[model samples]
Target: MRTGFRSVTAVVPIALAALAYAIVVPVTPARATPLPSRSAPQQRHVREVGDTAITTMDGVYTLAQATRGGNVFAAYCKSCHTPTFHSGPPFRAKWYGRSLVDLFVYVRREMPKNAPGSMSDADYTLAIAYLLRINGMPTGAKPLAADTAELRRIRLDSVPAASSPEGPAR
Candidate 1:
């Protein structure tokens, strides 16, 4: 019994020491590297109002393109969803301030419900143009490009403020 007690006493201290060492040995301070600087041209910033590249001010798409898109919407989209649903207040509320590219990508990938992603990129682009036009966004002289990168830069918030008699324009 004394031998057994001795062994347990000796083992417990050694086991605890091993555990303490195991817990304490692995911790080390971390060093982080600073990020490299970018050139002025490489760092593009979007400004409110004046910056055409970021804001959808003068309209991103052309009226001609929108007209063609209207045709596409009538043929492929009108059956399941109405233009009002796409361009109405509810739709604007959800989509405003987001990138037009997001809308384009969604429509291209998941539109036509029964036959999603079936439409060509051109068709999808036109459809978006039409929706923007109906939603009261301005129409630009140049058509909105089908390129995703360019589309990403343009925000979808070009809706005119609503007027209120009791307070300032909302």
Candidate 2:
């Protein structure tokens, strides 16, 4: 009985120590370390359209075109949808960080639900410009081309800094 009690006592202490260690080790915070920066070449990788790093200030489209698009949207799209609907939080949540071209294509292919692809390519591109404008993207001197390749190069990120009052300095 004496030997058994000693053995049990020894096992209990060991088990309690292990339990305490296991509990305390995981709860302890780990030391933080700074990550290494990427090389210039490594940082220059091809950026996708929806990348957060991309913005609309890269001269992707023109304000004049967006104005024309606004007219087009009023004529054809107003009956089915509202301008606010396309530029509101829901729209941002759905299209932010996507390809501008992808949105254009979808609009061209499946928009005006009653008659899809009914408008001319120029009109469609203009409509896209209007959408961008409404979403707070700044317009440039040049018009947005109807070409897919050109559009693909432009991304749909957050509103450009130029649009904000506290916009980035140049």
Candidate 3:
């Protein structure tokens, strides 16, 4: 009887520990290899009047917009994230193949961690532009429009072949 009680006590803690780990660690599915080179013609998806496929490589945001986003990031996000955090594997794991609208909505809804939804919608969109620029997405003549439909139209299909380790190019 005592031996059975001891066994139960030991197993209870182990079971609880396993339950806690399962609850805490999120499981992500295996991802495909990262796509390369925004400048590749094969990689670019042209958005025509009736055509719907558009990608980040198609110049989704402007330099000025990214610059403004950098400022907003410095003010609110820099406390926790360095510019490089927005690029490379980490960014890809979270955002690759997703639409920019996902990013916009995420930041608008759950960012700043302490004060979620604190910034203007435009500001959130601009921060996403900064993230794209740092990831080596080319700047467009026009800024990223802060519209859900427009943002949803552009998907992040590929990262650039070369991203500056220091930050976005000045």
Which model scores highest in lDDT?
Answer: 3
- Candidate 2's displacement at residue 153, Å, is 1.0
Please report the candidate that would top TM-score against the real structure. Answer: 3
Winner by lDDT between candidate 3 and candidate 2:
3
Name model 3 segments beyond 4 Å from true: 1-51, 160-170
Tell me the spans in candidate 1 whose CA falls farther than 4 Å from its real position: 1-53, 161-170
Q: Clashing residue pairs, candidate 2?
A: 50-97
- TM-score for each predicted model, relative to the true structure: 0.63, 0.62, 0.67
Give the least accurate 10-residue stretch of model 1, judged by summed lDDT.
Answer: 161-170
- Report the number of backbone clashes for model 3: 0
Where does candidate 2 stray beyond 4 Å?
A: 1-54, 160-170
Model 1 — TM-score against the truth?
0.63
Error of 1 at 53 (Å): 4.5
Sort all candidates by lDDT, best to worst.
Answer: 3, 1, 2
List model 1 lDDT by residue over 9-48, tens digit each. Answer: 8656544543563354332221222222345642343334
* lDDT assessment of candidate 2: 0.64
lDDT of 1 at 167: 23
Name the weakest run of 10 consecutive residues (lDDT summed) in model 2: 26-35
Better of 1 and 2 by lDDT: 1
